[model samples]
Every structure is written in C-alpha cells, then in structure tokens.
Target chain A: MSARDAVLGAVKAALGRSRPADPADPAAVAAEALALLADPDAVRPALPGTDAAVAFAARVVSPKVGATLDRVEALADLPGAVRRYLDGQGLPHLLALQPDPALQGLDWAGFELRDAALPDEAAAFGLARWGIAETGSLVFHSGPDTAVLGHFLPLHHIAAVRASTILPHLEDYAAVCGAAPRNANLITGASGTTDIEGSYVRGAHGPRFLHVLLVAD
Target chain B: MGTVFKRDVARALSDATLKTAIDRTTVTAERKRAAALTDYPQFAAARERGTRIKDHVVAHLDHYLLEFERNATASGATVHWAADSEEACRIVLGICRGAGARRVTRSKSMLGEEIGLPHALEAAGIERVETDLAEHIVQLAGETPSHIIWPALHKTREQVSALFKASHRDPHKTEDVEAMVESARRELRDRFLSAEVGISGANFLVADSGAVCTVTNEGNAELTTTPPRVHIVTAGIEKLVPSLAHAFVLLRLLVRSATGADLTQYTTFHCGPKRPGDLDGPQEFHIVLVDNGRSRMLADAGLREMLRCIRCGACMNHCVVYRQIGGHAYGATYPGPMGAVLTPALQGAEKARDLPHACTLNGRCQEVCPVGIPLPALLRGWRDRSWKDGLVPQSVRSGLWLWRFAAERPRLYHLGTAAAVRAMRLFRRGGWIGRMPLAGAWTRYRDFPAPAGRTFMEQLRDRERGR
Candidate 1:
C-alpha cells in the first residue's frame, strides 16, 4: 500500500469510524469541506463602533503595529498626502510604484517615480486589495499591477487603502479573499524583531516605516 | 530521549547565564501577553472559537487532509504524506535532491526540530541555513533551541556576540544588540538571495484554498518562502483547518498568547506556486504532511487532547517548574507542561517515565493555555500509567504501597501518623528538621517544617470536646 493509504487508514482505524470514507473520492470530500467553508460559523471579534475608516486609521496608528495613517477625501488628493507624509518624515520624494491603473493617473509634479523594482533605501507604494479594521492590516494580492517585491525590499512602504474596501473583521475580509491569489500578504505594520535580548527593533529584514493612505470617497 | 531528566536539570540549574536569560525574557513575555489580551476585548471568545475549531478538525481529520491535498494539487503544487519522521526526512531530502539544491535556507520550524531535519540534511551534504535570528544564534552555538518561540532566550548578549564573532567575519563587532542584528541581516541576506530551496513550517494549512499561512514578526519567513526556486512546507497533520475563517480565529489568539502582539508583522499566505503572471515567487511548491506518532495520540482518548496544541508556547511561559529549570532540562524537542504530557504520549510512557513526575501539579499551565487543555490531569494520567506498567522507581512504588496499607484502616493510620510525628520531633532542630534519613534529597536544599504539638485531628477533637 502507499504511504497515503497507510496514513489515512491508520487515522480511520484510530477514529473507529465503523466504515471509512475513500479519500481518493475528491467530489465527496470537496463537497463536505466546501459546506464548511461556504457558511462557516466563525467567531468574529466585536469591531470598533466607529466608522470603518476611523477604525482603520486608529488601529494603523496604534502602538502595536506603529504605522502612520493619512486620510484623503478623494483619489486626486493621494499625491499630496504621499508628498506631505514623505516631507514630514524627512524622506526623499522618490518612490517605486506598482503598475496599477488606480495609481497611474495621479499627477507626479515633484516626485520621481519608477516601475518594476524597488530602489535602494527608497520608499515604495502599492494599492491594497482590502483592509482589515480589527488588526489594521492591509491585504495585498500579488498580481501584474501589485508587485510582491514592492511590498518588501524597501526601507519605507506606503500603501493606498480605499475607505470603501475596509472590512470590519477578518471574516469579512476572508470573503473577499476567496479567489485565492497566488500570493497574499496581510502586513500589520513595519517589520520588527524582538529576537535579540527580547527588545523590539524595527526593520529586521523589511521596510522600517509603513505609511497607510486611507482614500475616502 | 531517555530518562536523563535529573542530570539534565542539574546542568541547566548550574548555568547562571542561562538562568538569568530565561528569567528576564519569560517575565517580559508574560507581561506583554497579559497586556495584549487586555487591549483586545474579545480574546476569550476568540480562544474558545479556536479550541472548538481545532476539536472539530481533529475529529474529521482524514476528510480535511484529503481536501487539502486535492485543492493544493489543483493549484499546481505537489503534496506528500509521511507516516513517520524517517519518511518525512526522506521525502524532504528527495525534494531537495530532485531540485539539485546544494544550499537551503529555512525559517524557524518546531516541526523541523521535532524530526531532526537539520542533522538529516547535513548528513546528506546539504548546507542548511537557519534565517531566524534566534535560530541562527542557536545553530552557530551548536546548541539545541532552549525555548520554543524565542529559541535564543537562553543566550546572553555576550554569548550571542561571541557566537557571531566566531561564525562571521566581523572581528571587531561590538557587543551591542542593534549592531548584532544588523550584522545578521547583512549576513543572511546573501543566503536568502542565493538559496536553491526554502523550507518553512506552516502556522496553519487552509483546506479551502490550499494555502500555507505563516506568521512571523521578523519577516524572515516571507523572505525564506520567497526568492527560492523550490519552496517546501513541512507541517504536522494536525495543522489542517477547514477554512480561512477558522484559521483567522486561531490566528487572532496565537499572536497574543505567544508574543502579546495584536498581530504579527507579517502573515503571508502562499496559496500555491507562482501563478501565470507572478513576477517573483517559487516556481514549485510542495507540502509534506507528517504523522510521526500523531495518529497514535489520536487513537487514545486520554491523550488525544495533546494534538490540540498550536505550538504557541504559552504553557511553558506560565509553568513554575519550566521558569526555574528552563527548556534544556526537559531533554526533548518540546519542553514544559505541554512537553511533559506530549513527550511521553509521542515517545511512549516507558521511555519518558520521569517527564510526568517532573511537574509540581501546578495548574498555572492549564490556566494560561489558550486551547484549554487540562495539562495537569494529563500529566497525572501518565504518572498513573507508568506506575501500572512498573516503570516507576522501586522506592516510589514501595512508599506508595506503604502509605496505602496504613491509610485503609483508621486505627493504623492514627497510630502511624502519631509515631512518625513523635519521631520527627526527636530530630527537630529548633522548629525545623535540618536533616532526615530517608528524605536527604528534600532536606539537602532547605529545612523541612516540624510538626506542631498535636496532629490536626487531635486538635480538632480536643476543641470539639471543650477540653
């Protein structure tokens, strides 16, 4: 018998399930698992009673993750928000941006923007596919427009999260992530490590500063 | 793996450096975990949900495992099954050899340690690099991990500096934490960029979408899973959850219980190998699900609850014995209260008979356990089994038998206790017993308390009679 058969058979014999179901029958197994997934009785935490954008902004600036948050009234105001955030942090006005159409039409008056790769010690910007308000994490799906490298490999990371896309809990966000992107990163804040003498130090191997721009309609 | 608990604990206690390191780190971790839970108002509900989800999954494990395999295969990844550690190691080595991988980079994986993967790979001439900062320090020191979450919690800054100085080319590096972290970042960056294969342990294996979720604060797991051509995920069969929603429920409690963080810095999900338009990711993805004595645990109802562990390491942090003796004393891949029950269950009661007796019956581990495992009860069950199997020491067995004989009858019990108290009074120095014959082990450290003028029953009877 195969290793899979031996392992599954052992589990069945241990469970003492009088008659074991065939594991090779994908349709029956999938149907059972899909029923659980389709309507999961998940325990969702009580979200903040404030607006979605307000909750997202508050959590993003919380001490746990330590990411700065900026709310803009419209997509047209994104460039100003990014410029002001960079100037406030005393960062240079150069960035590497993912090739998303939502970010393309922005007027780059005083900034030097590049594509495909993150520049050395520079900031990078990407659009978040969704925002989880409970943890203030920005969910980014890897695709042609959203470069996975742009999420990491930079000293500073700035993500644009539309207020409309902010979900109250992780269960709500799970609904939006059902399509199964090739790679999805739910980055809570800047990279940190407490490995050395149990001290919290930012920028272990990823971006040191994470700035979120909350774009409101 | 044998019963060397006494010798191992003696060595750990003498190491003043390890004691100080564990003292400082566990205190901070315990405080942070408490504070993080306070910040989240719904932590209790989340923990309950996590326990229920795990219990449900373990009940129907075969279906979920098959579901995960089918979905992962559909997403262009290969899934392998291993009934034991040897098969798991063989499959991992086979994958590396097939990929022509000479140098492999890995994140911190407790499962990897459980199966002794590093030794197997090294024996086969594959260079394995541990990318986690704590793991890297332990690897360089040629020591096993002393703590589960914080592997290098047993090392001092001076020790870490010495290890790094010896391993790396930085001869003049100072003994500063930031400088040490920067040096490791610089050194491991090259390994991540050039490694042929990357191996990581999954925090959760989602059956719905065939994703392997990894939570890390240092972002090393992300780098390890990325950049390499072949990414291999080695996880135990108990890691399966039915859906992403169920996974989120456990993830919410895991970070708080482990590090007191609202969420880790990175919770990346690797759904499968690189998709059609992906720019940079692993071209091939493989997941190795290893049983390694888990099915045996699942068979016995008394020990089945041990499989509910999420590898959070909270039980160890709150354990009184563990805080004093540290993880090295356990002499196993796992340690502390969870290890006390799980070590024997996984590696039979006969081989690890002393592990169950290592505890003080303190229920602090059960109190702080996120999954609500009755650890003390399980340890007591193991002790009972060992006694039945005659695996206990002869002295212990005889002492218990003598106590049982005297206690079964009221007259004999009263007379036995009265005579023992009178004899103890003879040897009392001032108010404490400074030394005793049969209890040299107990009296060697400190004085045993002397009995009062009368036993409790005599005092009670005198008070009731108005004497």
Candidate 2:
C-alpha cells in the first residue's frame, strides 16, 4: 500500500484502539494560555500572541544591562532616599559605589559596563535597553557566558532602566528590533515562584526580590 | 564490555529502588502534564506551530547552522562539532582541563546524560553537582532520570523529606520545602561561586546568532552556565533553529506542549563570552554540537522527521500504556512512544531489542506529537526490520507464522475460531472465565467474557436455512 493508505490504516486502527477522544477546542486553549501569561503569580506564564510573547521574552532575554554608572559616594552617604527606600523594604547589605576612577578602577565592578559576566554571588541592578515601564522590568540575556549568576543566582536582582528605554506597549519592541532575536529574555521585577505549593513563595529559581531603579537620568 | 552504556542499561532495567522512583514520578508527571494541557489554550496551536518551526529549521538546517556559527563566532563564542557522544564529551572535558576546573555545577540536560557526562567528568577528576531540584534528588539517589521533563517526578514529598533528612545533617533546624530548597540552593551556590567552569545543555541553538537557549522553571540552568569563567554547552545537533524569532516560536510551543505553562520561570539567552564592559559572565564560551546518531537518522527518509521532536512529553502523557507502565519499563533514557522509536534507531536493534515489542501500537503518541512524527508507522517499521533480520524470538516467529496462515484463508479462519470457541466454552461459565492456563494473568485482573461460540457465518447460515 501507499504511504497515504498506510497512514489512513494507522488512523483507523488508532481510532479503534482508544475510547472516543474529548473534543479539541483551539480558542479555549489560546485564551487559557493568555490568561496564564497575564497571571502575575504564574511561573513564567505563557505570553499571548506572537507580539506579547516576543516582548515579554525580550525583557527577560535581551536586557539593556551594562552601559554606564553614576556612582554616588559612600555606601551610607549614597542617596539617602535610595538607601531609605531599600531600608524601609527591609533590605540591607548594600555596598558603596564611588566613580573616582581609582576605586572604580577595575572593569569588574564598573557601572554600565558591557560584555562582563555577573559574578557568581554578586547582585547587580543594571539597565536594560528595553523595558515595560508599567511593570518596571529590565531586559537582558541570561546564558552561561552572559550575566550568568547576576541574572538569577544573586540574592538581590536590581535592574536600572532609563524611563526613555521603556516601551509604551510590548508590541512596539518587535518594530524596534525589526526582527525577533534568536533568544530573548524579559525579566519583570524579580524572579519568583510558588511551585512548592499554592503558598506563594519568592525566589525559588530567581532573585528573591526585584528592585527596579527607574532612573530619569 | 564494561562501558557506561552497559552499566546504565543494567541499572535502568534492574535497580528496584530506582525503578520504583521512576514509576511513581512518571505517573505524577504524566498527570500534571495532562492537567497542564487540559487547563491551557494555545496548546494545540503551540504544538502545530512547534511542528512547523522545527520542520522549517531542520529543512534549512545547514544554512541556519552556518549562519548561527558565523554570528556566534562574531560574538566571541567558539563552536565545536562532535560526530558522536565520546567526541562531545572529550571536547567538554578538555575545556574543563584547560580551565583548571576542579568543581562544576550542572543544570539538567538529557543530552549530557545521554553522553554519560558525570562519569566522564569524574574520570577527569572534575567534581560535578546537579543543581536542578529534581536532578539534585536523582543525583542524591544515584539514579538516572525516567521522565525527560520532570526528572524527579518519581519521588513523593514524604520520600523527598526522608531523603533530605538522611542526606543533610542540619535537617532539624529547617523542616519545610523552603528550607529544603534553601539548603540545596545554599550548597549549590557555593559550588557555583567557587567553580571555574559551568556546563549546561541548550534548548534551542539559533542559527542566526549562534546562540544557545536554555529554558527552565528553576534558575539553576542560568547559574550553572554562568558565574564560572569557562562555559561549555553539550547539545544535540537537531536543536538548531534559523533565528531568534524562530526560537520564540519553538519556545512558545515547548512549554505549552510540554507542561502547559505559558512560559518557564526563566528563559535566558547567551550569545557568546562576556563583552568588553560586562561585569559578570564566562570568559570563554564553547558549544559542542553532537551528531551521535542524528545525521544517520536524517538520511533515513522515514525516520528523518523524528529529529524534529522538541522532546515535549505531551505524547507520553496522552498514551494509555505509558501512563500505566511508566517510563522505566521502556528501559532507556527516553521513554514512552518517542523512546520506543528513538532508542532502537539510535542505540541499534540488538541493544534495545525489547523496545519495539513493548508497545501496544495505540498511536496516541502520534496524535499529540508537536512535530507530527508518524510514531506508529516508524515503530511498525522497526518491528518488520527486527523480524526480517531474524531478531525475533523463535516462539514469536512461530506464532506469527501461524497467525499469517490462518488469516490468509477465510475457511481456515473459521475452523480456527470454532475450535477456539469450543475450547473456551468448556472452561467458561456465567459469561466469565475464572482462569485459563496461559491466559491466567488476564483473568487474574479482569473477568474475561465468554466467547459467543457460534460463528457469525454459522448463525447467518442457520437463519437462512430456518433450522
């Protein structure tokens, strides 16, 4: 018999093999997928459509991290507002940054530096080239060679995004890039999950807290 | 004689504790998969799209792969191609040696497992720790993964708690899932910080950028590949796609089809090494493109489409038989309908001789395959080849021969059925047979309805004659 006949025979035999199939409703499946993606508590909810999907991904995958830094002096002397903001949130262990060139000498801890990997335990709040201003997310790439540990392994993941970097809508990103990236990452706030149960735990796979620095600068 | 393959096969088939672990985990995973698929939309769309994109990528693979390599090299990542698993392992191990890596953290990748990475790395004196929650459980248990998606799906909460207590010394101080995760995390975090190298698997290799994609519900995949100065990726050649746009399409389909998730918690992309102004990332990047048996598969027109599979477990979850026997019974790293077809083709018929016969040919796997693989047809091909090559047992051969003979002639078929019916009636009563010698197992679990005795033809004849 021809391949067509063989396929038909197989289908017939398969139909005989199982009980009646539950109907397949495609629209319901798509709606459900959109709902999951939009759900904040979802563990990487499926982004709806090709546009939302790509934008959400670009935020997580192609973050505009590693450009430049405006260091503000002593850890304590740094912006009181920034420190107090964090302190009110119950976060400590922040360090001081000085752009004196002598102290900010090495490429390792430089502000807005590109092509550097995140140190294994280091916390970084770098800027993403593109972001969802509404959600205050930083877009960047996470791979073995990119901000490897800084993306997820860090105790604190703070991403600084320029307000100008923010897209009015997620759809505008694809037009901005022209074509989709091979792999894009969109990170909104911090990485959190409740996979242990429905108990809503933070930081199962990513940073426990996501602090977004929406810098007007 | 003492190869890892032999040992793995033996361990997979006979290890009672591991078998139990795989069985329970696979069932739960299959259930979750069902729940996930049932609850999600775009599932069918994702499956269709996944099938189309993978097919497109594989169709123009040579162009896309070259393009990827060019872009990847441009971005400062070195790409290596391995003809087989050994070569891939050697390339990765050499990278470790060159980097002076004493310890390594691993994210779960079946490709790495397929190549027997841990064993090879250990031989090179590199300490490797599996950091994925499920992988950590399996590693601590010293077992291989049963389900591709949920590697530790076999373990129950109570079992994990017990394992946690026995495995860790400071268990009393922390007694919850968070604590258990924290302990594993804290321990692995130290390894990530100290290790000079990170090893991982790629979900999709973009041909346009020469980038490797790793999708995870957990962050360990990112941590394992990053942080270390030297990063190595061991991936199957079939994973390559044309571009990042295509990558998204596949990713969209993968999670939705595999676990019914819109997206995994972490979907990260790595282009190459750290750029000039980068703060953290590997100093170097190496990708090992493993052919193993895939190139051979591509040549076989019938089996070529199998390469398009994205390793989603949708088919396995929908399979009635797979749900019952679980993955261990399939006796390979890949289990279920996909495993039945892939193992024999990749490993050879003699090595995986039992796989083809193990299936009931239900074809449910084909219905749900994201890549539209004709699984049953391929399985049937394996069966025919096995028999033609004299791989079939003598008893099975004789039985088939008898069946073929009876099936060829309607008269002989009737004679056979009449005789069988008479024999069944002598032992059957109350529309049920309590037991039959060779068929005892069937009756043990279920009541066998008695045969109608009179052939349909005989009844037709009687009615016409008005006897």
Best candidate (score: TM-score): 1
> lDDT tens string, model 1, A1-217?
8889889988988877677663434566455545544433334455677687678888899896799888899888988998998899898898887888888888879988888654244688888989988889999988777777787777789999999999887888887776788788999998888887788878777788899999887
What DockQ does each candidate score versus the true complex, computed on alpha carbons? Answer: 0.54, 0.12
Across B1-467, the per-residue lDDT of candidate 2 in tens digits comes to 11334344454445555546545544554555566666555556555656766665555444445566778888788888776677778888888989998988888788998888888988888898887777787777787776788766556555666776778645525557677666665556566678888888999887656778887766777777667888888888789875554565566557666755445656767778876655567889988877777766765766778888888877776776565555655666888788888888778887777776667888878886766888888888888888889888798899989999999998999898888888888888798888887787467546788878687888888899998
Segments of candidate 1 deviating more than 4 angstroms: A22-43, A116-120, B1-3, B170-174, B422-435, B445-447
What is the alpha-carbon lDDT for the whole of candidate 1?
Answer: 0.84
Computed on C-alpha atoms, the DockQ of candidate 1 is: 0.54
The ten-residue window of minimal lDDT in model 2 chain A covers: A62-71
Clashing pairs in 1: none
Best by lDDT: 1
Q: For each candidate in the order shown, give its overall lDDT on alpha carbons.
A: 0.84, 0.63
DockQ agreement of candidate 2 with the native complex: 0.12
Q: Give the lowest summed-lDDT range of ten residues in model 1 chain B.
A: B169-178
